[model samples]
Target: YEFDATVKKVEEAMLSEGFGVQLITGIHDMFKKKLGIDDYPKYTMVLGCKPQLAKRALETSLDMGLIFPCSFTIYEEDGKVKVAHVSIMKIGAEIGLADKEAMAPLIEDTGKQVRRVWDKI
Candidate 1:
């Protein structure tokens, strides 16, 4: 997909997978205006969350709140568009923020949700 199409597709896919769209913003403008960088390609950040899942994770560990909103980055680099996501649940586990056994199911469910998002987009 092209830049705008990719952003739209990701928004629809995330909604279809039950994630609420928290924010969507172009990164190029921020970089250029705030940091005085002018040579960047198109970039967008998609912030999304399933509030129920976030609640559960936080109940398991308040520190999980640090990773509440999950995000996907879509950018153009080297004449190609790319999308990237790193699992917040897994990050919490690796960083010792979530209890291993307590968060296992949440991790599994969120992973499936992201898998569907990727598959659709």
Candidate 2:
């Protein structure tokens, strides 16, 4: 899929997965407006949240809310469109903020959800 199509697909997949489409930021457009640069490749950020899951994470640890919404960055590189996201649960564990054993199920479930979204995109 092209850049626009991929972005739309991601939004639809996320919504179908029961996540709220929070925000879609046009990074390249912002750079053109704020920095007066037109050479940057296309870049956008789509942020989504599964409120219940986020709430559960917070209940486990308030600090977990620091990165409440999950994000997927869509951009062009070497003329190829790319989509990517990071696992917030993994980040929290790696950074020693979340207990690995305690967040095991959440992480697994989140991975499954992400995988579904991936299969769609």
Model 1 over residues 3-89: C-alpha lDDT tens digits? 999999999999999999999999998999999999889999999999888998998899988876999999998899999999998
The residue-by-residue lDDT of candidate 2 on 19-84, one tens digit each, is 899999999999999999999999999999998789877876788878768999999999999999
Q: Each model's number of backbone clashes?
A: 0, 0
Compute the lDDT of residue 25 as modeled in candidate 1: 91
lDDT of 2 at 103: 82
User: Which residue runs of candidate 2 sit more than 4 Å off their true CA positions?
Assistant: none
When superposed on Cα atoms, how far off is each prediction in RMSD? 1.1, 0.9
Best candidate (score: TM-score): 2
Clashes of 1: 0
Off by over 4 Å in 1: none
